[model samples]
Target: MEAPLITADTLVALIPEILALAFIAVVLLTEVFGSRSPNLSSGLAALGALALAGSATVLLAAGFEGSFFGDGYVVDGFALLFKILVGLVAFFSVLAAARWSARTGDTGEYMSLILAVALGASLLVSGRDLFVIFVSLELATIPSYAMVAFDRRRRESSEGGMKYLLTGVVASSVLLYGLVLIYGVTGSANLSEVAAAFTADLSPAALLGLVLFLSGVAFKLSVVPFHFWTPDAYQGAPTNAAAFLSVAPKMATFALLLRVLIEGMPETAQAYTWLFALLAILSMFAGNLFALRQTNLKRMLAYSSVAHSGYILAAFAALTGPALETAVQAVIVYAVAYAVMNLGAFFVVELVGEEGKSFNGLFRTQPALAVSMAVFMAALVGIPPLSGFWGKAWVIFATAQAGAWVVVGAVIINSVLSVPYYFGVIRSMFFEEPAGVGPVKDGSGALRFSIYAMAVFTVLFAFILGPLVLLAQAIGL
Candidate 1:
């Protein structure tokens, strides 16, 4: 057989991935033989992420669209939107990591691993074939495993990394088995082909495969029953890694889940919808209830993450023909809102301390951080005029439109249940007496920049809802 032609369009479609890989190479090479400066390496990574984001934006504006490698890879509106999101997250993560590495040392390896993970996430969002998706997921996850263990001096780090690794391996195995069954039933690994093969009367084997596939994605999203490793992993990993892991991976996986279900298994939407509804309910109550009792800030945030995943899942469960586009918009908007607020909250945790009590009297000392934390908390509880409020509101609206009242009610109740824990940090910061004699150590400049930038974005996102809605609508199609 003759080799398939690789055209200029194919190369152009791959510029984001190519640029990310080049950045990774530069970071690693600099670590080995160059200045060995953490700041420089992280700066380069951040700049590269900005460049990639700019490229994605330009491509998006130009309405660039194409597929390559027999449709295994795609650069379309959906892919471009997610690529831009992944790039922004990577830029913030690198900025945060620069401060972390300066304190902990090992700057080059740290930045390089982050870039590698970003590359993987970017690839995952653009993947259109089963093989490509699997490889991209592994690429995104493996580096995260290393990052969880990067703080070798801490025993909890090792423990967290081990648990995360074991859980991930099992999830990957289950996911691969599901993919094999899918290929067996459809005789194709291409998502579009699989969609064409799937029928309303799905076979038991195909149904099982679909369930297993969702189970794998559920682990990444940290939904209930598949979220056993989340709190430990978050509490144990370096805070910056936890922040990145909490946002970027979830966004990418959610993107993949949307693609797989909507494109590859639309015929089974009703079955998956019910399954997701059940998971969403379980995750919301379980995560919030567990968080309510937590004293450690990281663990609380980890549980909060699980609950937020439920919010996004609620949107997924509400998917129907009439509500389909709206549901997609809900998920995307929520993902971005969650990324900004959640990352800001984690940055605060990194600045103050990981324990909830450490925030006592923060308003008396770090007034700016205290105020920012309060905004994040309010936004998290779905208070109006904040990005998070709009995110949850959209999900509720979409679910109501789809007649998924159970999901809508669950989301509302979860939002109420979440308030106590979310505000607990605020109370500690503003109302409680100081536990220490002085202010918390001011974070490094990069860390401060990340925190302030995210905080500003969280507040400003509400005003830009119109443009964001349009963007989401564009990508949904």
Candidate 2:
């Protein structure tokens, strides 16, 4: 086939994503030869990369639509918005992992994987074709499996890594099968073509293909019925890895889902609404209820992440014109907000083990860290005066507007149910006396900054939600 017309406009539009890949290459080369401590090198490279990606993002946003190699790759408002979000998330995650890298003495490889994962996430956000999306998802996932077991000294980490790899493989295969079905039905792998295919026919075979495709999407998003791997993986992975895992993948996956469902399968919405509605309810209830029983902070947040997936799904099920746009904006903003809060919370928890003690006695030893953790926990619970509440409020508003009242009710009820578990961390911190086991040391200056930054954002997210909502609408998403 003649090479699709490549235009300057398209190349400019994709500069952020293209430069992101280039940054990864630079990091890889530096790691290959730079004599500096790998940890320092990795940290600096990761930070520099995110900064470069941010600049690219600004450039792309300043211009307009650009397509590459025919209709294969798209640079648009939707892609730019998600690319920025993923870059920010990856940058923060690298910051969170800095100390962990230093301690493990494996900073170079770990940091390199982080850069690679970020590149993958960027690809996922920008993907316009099924093949590209699947490849990008693998790009993100493979590095994470290694990160999970980055510290070979820990058996739990190894187990977690194994479980993550095995489960991820299964999910990937299932998703691929679904994608193949779409390709068969549509005779095309482009997302837009798949949606057109849905409208062309209403056959059992077509419906099966649609359902199968959605199942894979559901797995990636960690929606109900396919979320069994989440908690174990979260609990077992290194804390920083868990934080990265929790935020970055979800951001890209959701963006991919939005593009595919809304743009690629608009005609299937009416038929698929109920299925999404049911998944939303189950994910919320199951995640929230299970979270209530968890004592491990990482595991609790894992369930909380799962619950948020339900909330997002509920919004999707309830989507209309501007409602879909609003909900998606809410999802992206909330992803950023959650990344900060969750990573900060984990950072503090990691500090609690500073004096060679597990994070069991946080309240008595480190009151300030405890309080910051409380803010994060409260935000996660959707309490008023915090960003989490507004994040959830927009989602609920979108769901209600879509007329998915049942789904809305389920989300509200789940949010209520979620409060106790989220607050359970706070309760452990302030309400109950610390175990008084040992001294609690605080985090490094960088960790402190991360925590404070997240706390400030969690506190201020509601005020910012309005503009983000406007930005979302402007995108025509």
Candidate 3:
């Protein structure tokens, strides 16, 4: 056969993925030379993830656009944007995991799995075919289940992993069935072909399939009604794992939702408006309201993350031209801000817990972490002068523009209701005195830098919204 077509862009597009895979290999091999030193493996892995991210940055700046593998792989502004975010999320997640991995004695495996997760996330965002998307998504999730169960000594960890496994299998089956239906109807799984199949004459079977596929994606995003697993999983998982889980998958899912909804279900918009709307309202109300009573800090953040997913759904529902761009912008900005705050919160918890005991007396012992935790909590609450405030403002504004009056109201009410619960965490840290002496350790150098960097990013991005806005626009919304 003649040589397949080759392009400079395709070569560049593979850069990050290749680097990530190589790093995973090298880290595994490095462990052989120093089997007792998991730290060496973890440090190598962190540097490799950074290198992967840097490669992605370089490729993104070089500006490659279009699809590969007969339209199975895509490289566009939107894909690049999400890939970059995934890279950053992985990079920070590595930073967050360093000390935790060292403490847990699974540094090598943890770092390797995290890299694998990043690879899956990158593929999920850039996949142009339904089959490719499905395969890529599983790659992302399977590793997560193992990562959650890494601490086999902890019963909660096992339970959490089992719960995730059960939910994940069911969700994957539903999504696959949905894809089968669409393939039967359209005779193809390519997104563009599916989009072309949308018509005023679509059968009910097609609609059902579309909805099932969406339901699967909804579960991945932890939208309400489908979000029952989030709090439990977050609570049971290790703090570092929870922090990683909170942002990475959601960002990829957001990009995937944008692609599937805009590309697959165009014909059934009217039929599905109610579905999206329900998810949005429930995620917002359920996430925020249920979070109000949680005493465990990670669980509270889990629910809060759920609530934020709802807001992003609302933005997704309002998908038209500038309106869609604004909504997506809200999600990107919020994702960035949420990543910062959530990581910062986990950093504080780990900082407090570092004394080889559970965290206690957070305020009295680690005042720096306590104050940093307060700032992060406030950001999650969408308070002003914080990036999260702008994130919500943009989403609500976009919803109003779309004439989604009920959802707009629901968004407003949810924000109002979320305040007390978020503040409750802050209040516990700053106002309530420690009931007793707990873990009394200061943060390590890596942990301290993670906290400081995230805190600064959250506050700094709150002020510079222009670049993110431009990025959303450039991503074709």
Candidate 4:
């Protein structure tokens, strides 16, 4: 008899994803057969995320590692870092949604979908095979469709979701084509094998596959020219959903990018780095410039997300050097900072409203909330001693050290360009008079608590900057 393909160690390494699936199953069953307590459902989802993060961290610390299913899946420090990131995003998303979830009721499916996205994100960060990446990417993406349109009662939700799905389909198709071309050229779906087969001089088909595959990844990362879907989706999706989508998918997709570029396609780094540089420059200018015209807070932030993508890519553009690991670590740290500040900002939008005017006189009404928003906005502006500053500082340090001066310039210039609008938010909150009573819309303690926690991190993250770098080195790309 043939030995089992699955070993005991495989199961142990798979614990995080398994836990996500198990929670997903329980969530669905509860929706179908159990009582309809929104708290229970959301609580379970949050708890599951907590467990997933805890498990991933434990595995990372325990030095657990595995490659399973013929190298299609693997677990290592890199994957665990993303798993931990995804879990934190999911958990905070639930906490952000707690008040809204409770008030709206029927959160079973909502929480279930979040868990499903989390599970797929976990899978995506571990994929080492073309087929595995595609499957995991879809699993991570499909649920987001429903999530964007979760407010089926609203027309914008439907339209945004439809546009998202249609455009997403095209991106995915293009991605699939690229994957198929690479598979055909290389005759293997395994990334490591494919990389080993590639040479400095590649076939036309291989080059095309490389470009197309990157385009698809660009769409996921919201790189400019591929980011048209972002503002519409954020404007249309529920605020909480926007928060989750902004962070989770991007982080996972970035992990995939690191795997492909660093581990799977180092031979193609010259071309890839050049492309990333071009895209990074374009994304920075376009995202910042366009954001200047948006009066809606969500749209502005959507554009901000685009700009931040460019900042991270500025660091990523430095992946050409011998010190690739340091570049990769910079990208990861930037992602974490982006997640924290963006989530904090969006959670506030969730609490108040989406209109830029929503923040008018916020300081007059709620001091804590206003102060928190200030920290987040300041961080986004890359002010010193905040998380955003640290994120930008590291990116600048790493990119400059790698001699990617042009990319560093773009990041700095764009940060300056973003000042007017970002600080415009602050001025409105502190300088303007309140339009009405009870400026806060949600009134949920959960939302308040979550927002406060994120703000705390945004401010105190400077203290943890050292650990983040150490953790990146310990886990690695």
Off by over 4 Å in 2: 1-7, 36-39, 353-364, 435-443
Residue pairs in steric clash, candidate 2? 195-264
**Runs off by more than 4 Å, candidate 4:** 1-3, 440-443
**lDDT for residue 253 in candidate 2, whole number 0-100:** 86
* Residue 161 in model 1: lDDT: 94
Clash statistics: count for each candidate: 0, 1, 0, 0
Error of 4 at 309 (Å): 0.8
**Cα lDDT of all candidates, in order?**
0.88, 0.74, 0.78, 0.88
Residue by residue across 170-202, what tens digits does model 4's lDDT show? 999899899999999989999988897566688
Candidate 3 lDDT over residue span 1-477, tens digit each: 753666776777777888888998887776656674766877778777787778877766877677888788887878877777887778877877887778777688788989988888988988878899999999889899988777767798889888988998899899889988988888898988987776646788887788788889988899878898888788778778888877887889888978877766555653455667788998999898888877777777788889988987887767754466566677677677777777787777656642212334467866777778788878878888886787778888887877778988998888789889767666666666676664544336776788888888877875567887786777673
RMSD of candidate 3 to true structure, Å: 2.4
What TM-score should be assigned to candidate 2?
Answer: 0.93
On the 0 to 100 scale, the lDDT of residue 454 in model 2 is 76
lDDT of 1 by residue, 1-477 (tens): 865668888888888888888888888898889987878888889987876777888889989998889889888898888889989998998888787786677887888788888888888988889989999999999999999989978899999999999999999999988888898899999999999767678889988887788788899899999999999999999999999999998998999888888888786775568888899999999999999999999999999999999999999987777888889899989999999999999888877779888899989977888899999999888888888999999999889988999999999999999999999889989999988853445457888788899889889987778888988877675
lDDT of 2 by residue, 382-448 (tens): 8887877777787778777777788878877887898887666666566555566543343365656
Give the poorly placed runs of model 1, Cα more than 4 Å off.
Answer: 1-3, 437-443
* Better candidate by lDDT, 2 or 3: 3
Clashes, model 2: 1
